[model samples]
Target: MDEIATDNRQGILTRIRWKAGYMNPALRRIADRVLKAPDEIKAISIKDLALQCEVSESTVTRFVREIEVQSFQHFKILIAEELSQGSSSTPPITDRHVYEDITDQDDTASVLSKVAARYAMTVADTRAGLPAEALEKAVLAIEEADVLGFFAMGASLLCVENALLRFMRVGKRCLFFRDLGIRKFSISTLGPKSLAVGVSNSGRSISTVDSLRQAKAQGTTTLAITSFPDSPIVRHADICLFTPTVTGVIGPAEYHESMVSKIAQLQVIDVLYSLYAVRNFGRAIEGLERTSDVTALTRY
Candidate 1:
């Protein structure tokens, strides 16, 4: 995955100063105070900040507006970004009393229930947010393409390989590439008559992004199935499909959020396969019969 550029405190302070130049004197003074002591101001309430700056609450509000942030809450994100860049050590806990109040509740049943609930929520959110237009476009692209290339890396590679099998069963010409080198080779060879689909939950996989780029350069229609539309993969894709997945470190454990995203992608492929079958009903029926005949010979 492509690394996301982290914003630092200096960067935020610089932006604030640049924006402050265009603001009225009252609003600019408020911005100057906040930028001068960002850490101190971050800990202060907006009301307290307004009081400290000797400005009306509206003036403080106007200051945030001049900086292009929605509100003080968003402005604090810049401060947090700055603090994060400077802090090598862990953050100090302000809520020590809460930690002391915690009792031993780490039962297996409780853990299982929480995990199941999180997974269920992921699935529900992904299904609810499925884009209808993107889904239809992907289905049509697969159905009409001379060849369909499926590319994924890490856990998503498993999903793409399974989808290749499913597409093959329905008489589609499909190829699945889990190997990075092979993926690049295939993309270079594929032509405009082909379609390339890549799956990545983070949408930052370098290999997946590179493969899509190569495919597009070769005149192939590129599609990206990912959880984030704002990711690098989306930029190179002709069609972008998305699913909902929470972003975080899951420790040394398997990622349940990514699993949910994979399930959502598979559901999309299933829908595409069904549509393709309906559109080419006679051909699909003939293919099924041929497979049944081969099975009959083995059974006897």
Candidate 2:
């Protein structure tokens, strides 16, 4: 009806071209159900649609609102209009695609391609969805903190370690805790001037959450880089950066998702680091020069 709402509806259809990867969970579920049975949903009642999706009527209502529809009636009208115009946009692949791609690949190249594509998608999704204010908060935290502590469990530890090294090279006091006991002990000592960054793909790692909680309780600035926004860890964080997980059948092969999520986390950290270097370029250069002089005699 209104110009802004009209624009959102058109935008939603266009976003479908990028797949529904950026849609919130509730809206995504509704989109998936509707796309699967476009013809049937065009005439179905909202109550029946909720029953079919196993979600509440309010969820359906919220989904319609997300697409800028005034109500279910308008939503159905738009759906019918699209259908009549022969709209046949395909919904994005679900968890099944992740499993299917891995199980069906016969060559190393093909497997690697799929894995690379997933990571690329994660990066694109992360960049597309990242909010400007969150980026600014993270940058400011890195800039003003007296110390930076990184906590990550499982393979995510590797990404945190790399980030710690990068910051250290720029003369920032950075530490990565891979041991759960040591991490908790360290967190207890953080103060208002310190920053604690936790990385978890699912955002549900118990140890990581505990570490953040401890840090926050001590007045430390806590930030979380996670795939799930609803994760408990985010509640305690001063800043929350999200990454989209590539869902697949649960198993060892889920490592693919882990890797993609890590890339997204690292991209965020990279931006923070770049901003820090720019803000303190002169000081960083001086530190690099001093380090070079001390190590000059040891070089071959």
Candidate 3:
């Protein structure tokens, strides 16, 4: 295998940690092994690494490719280079180990530090991991859509609410409903000129997936902001925007999305809103001024 140029790459380990959250069980084991022991990985052969991670040799190849490395040799070379440098491309979060979960043995200060680190890392990694092409398509869809419909449930709904508020200020017609029946009805009313965005970290939420499904059936452009690239939501989405799976900072086996996931999703929302506003600068500013004026009246 041809060696990948280490100089051309930035933060190989950071990329692995970011993408690890969305990986399948087998691939995740490989990633966990690599992140935990880069020095060991650099010295281990592919066959040995595969055996150690309890995955097949092919799964090891897939993990390397998923992180955009060309081959296992190239992956090890990069790890070796990173190790020789004596530091990671991404700065360390406090003095604590990366991806260390908050434990009950910690005090209030430790919790604060860990939570802050998680938030910072989630934002940085998410920004790095998002696909530019998909983001561009999502922005264009929003710019051209006659109406925008957001579908999410649970903590994911908080992200939707923030998007609704921000987009509304920029004069976008947005729809969101907490009630499933009402949300489904609202989504059903949207047709070809509308955009449907479903937010789900797991990508398996029944309501969110069904809402995207309903939108696609109506020929509305569908966009998904999810951690899992192959999740059910992606099957219905015309465009998919990914956020780093912040699961690294929390329990590894925790299936439910955490508060850190919301932070990551919120950052995606802010990016989308900013890009849309930039594309519609004049109208966006005017709408913002108008809305600000109206909202100011209610304040004091």
Model 3 lowest lDDT segment of ten: 1-10
CA lDDT of 192 in candidate 3? 99
Best by lDDT: 3
Better of 2 and 3 by lDDT: 3
Predict model 2's lDDT versus the native: 0.70
C-alpha positional error of residue 256 in candidate 3 after TM-score superposition, expressed in Å: 1.9
Model 2 earns a TM-score of: 0.66
TM-scores for the candidates? 0.60, 0.66, 0.72
Query: Can you write out model 1's per-residue Cα lDDT over 166-253, one digit (the tens) per residue?
Result: 6676677887655677767777767898999988877788888988888898799998887654468877899876655533211111
Error of 3 at 48 (Å): 12
- Model 2 stretches with alpha carbons more than 4 Å out: 1-101, 248-257, 292-300
Error of 2 at 23 (Å): 12
Instruction: Report the error of model 3 at residue 47, Å.
Output: 11
Score candidate 1 by TM-score against the native.
0.60
Off by over 4 Å in 1: 1-106, 248-257, 292-300
